[model samples]
Target: MSEYKATYLVVGGGIAGVTCVESLAILHPEESLIILTASSLIKNVSNVSFYAKTIVKFDVHDTEATSLHKIHPNLNIVYDSLKHLDTTNKVAVTESGIQINYNLVCICTGGIPRLISDSRKCKRILGIRDTESVQEFQEKLKNGRKMVIVGNGGIASEIVHATRGIQKIWVIRDDYISATFVDPGAAEFLQDTLKSNIEKNDSPVLRRHIFSEEDTLVSLNKNLKSAALGPDWYRKLENTRNETGEQELEIIYKVEVESVIEREDTEFPLDVKLSNGKTVQCDFVISATGVEPAVSFTWDIEPKFGKDGGLAVNELQQTSIKDVFAAGDVACASWEHAPHWFQLRLWTQARQMGSMAAKAMHSKITNEEVLQDFCFELFTHCTNLFGYRVVLLGKYNGQGLDQNYEILLRMTRGHEYIKFVLKDGRLQGAILIGETDLEEMCENLILDQIDLTLFGDDILNPDIDIDDYFD
Candidate 1:
């Protein structure tokens, strides 16, 4: 057993943990900062660009954990899994029997893939989350003739678009695809693009860089899970295909996977029973249902958890436990949220929360007043779906708003789709699909709360030049 001490400790090597430690190193270079992570690889965010006040675009790189030490001499990276957190004593014990004493600690362990109920019973059921699991899925896909994907989230969508020359059976409980992010109209618009991509058999040409010895070492520990893969993780994977150049996709809507039964005679080897009384025979099933917070370590005093099974946190990212905080997917914002802002477990929120938590922690230590981050005032996200850039601002899907709210839409079929949610003639939310380039304008409108009752539906008119009109 060994003992170490730090002024600040952060757990997990994902975006949130890295961001927190990096921010701390920048803010307090004289203080000792330690990051203990289960994974040897850390997610590094670079080339960051803000599309709006809160909307951001950046590149995520899975680099060696030691690379951070090189950048911040005050930051120490420890490769170990958290076994216990003695919050009362301000100490953390690792699975390897190493103990860390800290003045303050932040948990950004992220989340684990929410597997199907019967996932443990069958080896054919795979849940894609970390690097190792994705590699396992890729290996299985090489010989897989058919696959059943069970989810309607971003992960499922990415898998559907990335794989080629294989028959894909997409099973979803929702009527429309990508229900988690977009509305029905946007979902409908994306259908053509999804089909076109499948027909074209477009495959990602980029390949992941070779893994280092440290990365391989972390993967060997099956019990210790790494951080969730980044947004563009699918691009780095090999585009597996079958012997024939035929790629087919079948979407089973409004159904759930009831059970998975092992087949004795069929070549597929597994039979998937659906809630809609349909059975699918496929080589494997990908469970992209979602994720649960990765809070496996025990604590002296258990922290409050939200309905989503994440550590409940206040506006300052502080958990109920004293001197303890949480960020990223493992954290649930229990405080009253801004009207247009809500929490979503994405890399964007993880980075924002991590950076905010660092400032909050610094304030707590220095007894300095700190305000909540401006990023929390509005909800913004930038992602790509079906090869089209998708930007979501505010209540993009009109979430939480009553039926009194109105919607204005302007769609160009296969080219672009724009939707605006209005309440009392003010821009409450907006969704911009394709290369609309209206993100900044729409975001400003939502934030400014400028009334446009007089403009009416002409707000979306292409010839009107709303940007100039607003100016």
Candidate 2:
């Protein structure tokens, strides 16, 4: 075993891991650090792999930005996997038999798709984890064939819509779609959108939905456990449907594959056995089932929790073990107020946790100061779904409800939904879909900690203008 030591052993080179290491080096230039990753740096990213894709969010992204990183002498990407973590000994072992001793270890590996071993008849399926996969699917789609997408989250829906014109079926585990993220009212609107699309030849419906279990499914928060496909994926269903009783492919939901057998003499199609006790033939099976943090860690310590199990910590985002800290998608956090759920997920929370943890670790700041700076809304998560910018602030729908915050909501533009929770006139949390003006409000409520109770009943009205609050 090769033994090494560093002040910080930053495991996983994803966003949170990257941010944390960069902050550490800048803050404490004297500290030695090492970064671990399963693959080499995302330099030679191709159009077919999923790990590295050019995020097209930037207009005319200078693709040359990665070239500059290639020359960074200190930028070391350890091509190794975390085999074991001994939080008690403050040591971690990698797949390559490298044992590392550390004062602090951070895990920011991000996530992996909940996989299905069974292929059934779907052969050419892939998850839309990154740009390479999407571009690859795009190329294959040009040839035109039937494809079945499993699961009904944003990724599954996005891919379904992106490949709609080329024949597609949305395989949902439950009836309808989106059961986890959006509200019921929004879901109703989404259903109407799908219905309208099908009527106007904008999309096609193979059937209402397929179910793995019985008619009704229960969610912890009564939110849709699933229903409503984003416009991008379902709208394409219209193009693939035949109006004149032509042969049709299948789009199943709520059904699990009991078995998947490899097909002979073809690079495509997996023989899939369904949970419904039926066999279906599919050319491709894309699984968007869900994701778990890609934590390649197993620790033996008094730390009370592993990667899948969230960590228990105070506002400081410190783990059960002290001197040893955690943040991003690995640690758990709770507050004295309402909706106090330990979280180790989401990009916004990851960044905020990284910043807070960095401050807490520095000898300069006091714990009280760090705790005071810790606010739940600092964990603001936003995403672009089906051309709509949706932002979720704080913990809203979950098993744990903290009475410290209140829920405020309104109908934004058409299908867009907006909701915010306040505590003592100050904004604690919010969720806004579509054009609810999140860019402006998120900054105010989170950064300024403004008391908005003065907005009065106008808060219920979406017509209320937002420009006055900027100052």
Candidate 3:
């Protein structure tokens, strides 16, 4: 096996790994950095701008790993799959027999979609994670009339919203939709858009390539799992309804999958038995059942792991094993997180953690005191659901605040929905749907912790400009 040396090394070419290597390159231009990724395409964060303190906007580009040479000269992208990592000696071995010894290493392997059933065992069920999975789904969806979706996260939510003219039966374990992001009220508001009778012809969905695709999927060893799809992966694809009939969408709430039986007797290929005592016979099944971190590389040196199975890292993003660090979905923060900042495996957090981990490593190398990033002060996310703009800040849905919080909500049927969570007259969280233009204001409110007891119910009044009132 040929051995190489690198000053900084990153594994997994998703947003987290790319961000870490880029930051390292920028921070120490003289040093050489290497990235080992399984996928041919690497996700890079571009057009970055901080709209607010923690609220930032950026576009994710899935570029060919080879083309990354144009972005940074010192940074090198290696198209190889990692087989084992030896944190004891600070060395990593790839499946191709290329060994690398690095002074500092960061694992950004991200996570893989946790399917309801094992992929190898079930040919009829597939989990949406990469372009290839989506392609497979599209081919099956072409002739599919009835489909079953298992899970209620972002991927499942997007899949249900984008697909049309097909009988979609969403199997959710929660009573409300989008249990990961929105509250029951917001779910209800967004659920209306999925109605078959609702006319949504005026707005055309934009389907364009955000990044230059130079390479296709590469054949990796069975040990290496593919990285999770980045942001806008669903929007870029063509989601059109081909079936012509009374299309219906049914929700089977508060149920779990009991078993998946491949039946040759039925017209459909598979029969899915649910916990609710119903058998769903459909063309195929979609498992967006969430993801577990892809951290098998740590098998050589078992680091402290969190409950979610991610490597446990401190506030500085350092793993229990020295010289080895982790970020993105692969790392779980074990430190006392800020009251508002909680862990969610989102693109924004991946970028933040990656950049922060780079800083932490740089500080260790240079023996400099680095302050923690302020982004951790609050939780912020911007996404769209059913053609509606959505912004979530801080403890948006009262998350950990429990019953100690009071909520103020405002709605403008089919146009906008706003909710603000206040605790002891101080702003705790806020959710804005449909271009409310209040993300910045609410972010500041949550950070500043100003008393809002005086405003009372006028806080969410439609006519009241909350920004001006605060000013």
Among the numbered candidates, top lDDT falls to 1
Give the per-residue lDDT digits (tens) of candidate 3, residues 46-91: 7776667788767776778877676568676677888888877888
Model 1: number of clashes? 0
Better of 1 and 3 by lDDT: 1
User: What are the Cα lDDT values of the candidates?
Assistant: 0.83, 0.52, 0.78
Better of 1 and 2 by lDDT: 1
* Worst 10 contiguous positions by lDDT, candidate 2: 51-60
Query: Whose lDDT is higher: candidate 2's or candidate 3's?
Result: 3
Ordered from best to worst TM-score, the candidate numbers read: 1, 3, 2
**TM-score-better candidate, 2 vs 3:** 3
Quote the lDDT for 207 in model 3. Answer: 18
**For each candidate, what TM-score against the reference?**
0.92, 0.68, 0.90
Candidate 1, after superposition: displacement of residue 310 in Å? 1.1
lDDT of 2 by residue, 83-199 (tens): 888877888899889888877776666565565664223446565544355555566666556666677666665564334445566666656555455544444444443333333
The alpha-carbon lDDT assigned to residue 398 of candidate 1 equals 66
The whole-model C-alpha lDDT of candidate 1 against the native structure comes to 0.83
